[model samples]
Target: MRQLIVTEFMSLDGVIDSPGGGDHPHAGWTFKDIEMDEAAYEIKGREQEEAGALLIGRVSYDEFAPVWPKMEEFAEYNAMPKYVVSTTLTDPQWHNTTVLRSLDEVAALKRGDGAPLLVHGSANLAQNLAAAGLVDRYHLLIFPILLGGGKRLFAPQDAEKQKLKLVEHATYGNGVQMAVYDVVR
Candidate 1:
């Protein structure tokens, strides 16, 4: 079975929304604070290379589709197979894109054998996947700053006790912490 890896750029206060210039007031906070070094770029490149597919939400897909395709850095992301979970998203203009309408479909996709399905910046989808015990691993790049009011990675309503085993951790020169956790089932 393919592992569902939830990768997020989050704040110290657990806020995951608008890390890179969005509608949120704390937009571009990650860019403003954390200095991306060669190591960071290498890490991102490694993750992209390892991921066979991307499972993202409609909002994330809409936010990324136009931009990632234009950038040379995200060429791998643009070329990889993508599954966007949205009932309302009809036409996916990006190449190798498919629209998934239900959670059952998502679960089925998880059962298939492949490289890790990397999920990026899809807070709603991530929450659902976590709640369903579908997320196999979490790769969080935590910035030092705290954004008190914003969409969080884990909300209050998500009260289920899901145990996690710390697999790896590292800190960059800019004080950004990279933590990898395995969801203990």
Candidate 2:
């Protein structure tokens, strides 16, 4: 079975929305203050390389589709199979893209034999998957700064108390702590 791994860049307070510059007031917060080290880059590259397929939400798909195709660095990711979970996204123009409409479809994808399915920057989708017990693992890069308000990685009101076991952890030179956790089922 393919593991559904959610990798997110979060603040100390657990905010994950718009870490890169976007409509959010606290946009570009991740890079604005701290300098990411080569270790961070290496980790991201390794995650992408290890993934058999990419699963994303509509918001993330819209943000990535236009940019990744034009960048040479993302050639491997562009070539890899992508499944975007969206109720409204009908025609995905990106290469090797499939639009999935329901949680049942995601469940089916997880049951398939493959390398881990990696998810990035899809807070809403991530929350839904976590709540539904579809997410198997979490790879969170926790930055030092705290954003007072923004969309969070885990919303307390929407999510039930799900236990996680720490698998591994590393502190990068850039003050970002990379923590890997397995969902305790």
Cα miss at 114, model 2 (Å)?
Answer: 0.8
lDDT of 1 by residue, 14-127 (tens): 999999988989799988767765665455788899999999999999999989899998888888999999999999999999999987898999899989999999998999
lDDT of 2 by residue, 1-185 (tens): 99999999999999998887676788998888779677865667888789999999998999999998999988878999999999999999999999999989999999999999999899999999998899999999899998888888898595789999999899988888989999999
lDDT of 2 at 59: 89
Assess each prediction's global lDDT (C-alpha) against the native: 0.89, 0.90
Model 2 gets an lDDT of: 0.90
Model 2 Cα displacement at 112 (Å)?
Answer: 0.8
**Candidate 1: worst 10 consecutive residues by lDDT?**
34-43
